[model samples]
Target: MASSRWIRPEVFPLFAAVGVAVGICGMQLVRNICTNPEVRVTKENRSAGVLDNFKEGENYAEHRFRKYVRNRTPQIMPSVNGFFSDPDLPTN
Candidate 1:
């Protein structure tokens, strides 16, 4: 067995937390650089007309995404209550 004389295990959580925070910050920074309307680093981005941006925003607003379950309450154990309560369920 090789004896370890390196970093302490107690500091592992701190390191993991720092890594997660750094990763989140990095993702947000990249997203802002790519999508933020005010950021016009490229020539094409700078040349885009205001009406084009307005149309893009309108396109996004007009398309509404649908959820899977409509007019239904969310449940932690989805089938448990239904299985016990359904009158027509087979009981053999």
Candidate 2:
């Protein structure tokens, strides 16, 4: 035959400790749910969107660098045959 006592004197403290721990955890869970605001996953908030914007800036930088290079390219040859040879070239 088994004893049907709910709280055995030897194990009552252990059961109480477990119950207290579970209650504390449950209270924290409820508190977090109530206090935390809802978060939405929008396109602007996504990492991929952020990275895309960075990539766009990188591309713009590259474009500006290429434009700078193009502007700096040496114009060794004159357009007209006697343009550079003539001393009377327009001051403009």
Which model scores highest in TM-score?
1
In candidate 1 the C-alpha lDDT for residue 9 amounts to 92
- TM-score: model 1 vs. ground truth: 0.47
Give the CA lDDT, 0 to 100, for residue 73 in model 2.
37
> Per-residue lDDT of 33-63 in model 2, one digit per residue for the tens?
5432232255454434323355645554466
Shift in Å, residue 71, candidate 2: 64
Candidate 1: what lDDT?
0.68
lDDT per model, in order? 0.68, 0.60
List the pairs of residues colliding in candidate 2.
Answer: none
lDDT of 1 by residue, 9-92 (tens): 987898899999999999878866775666677888678845457765554444433244554577867677777888787766
The number of the candidate with the highest lDDT is 1
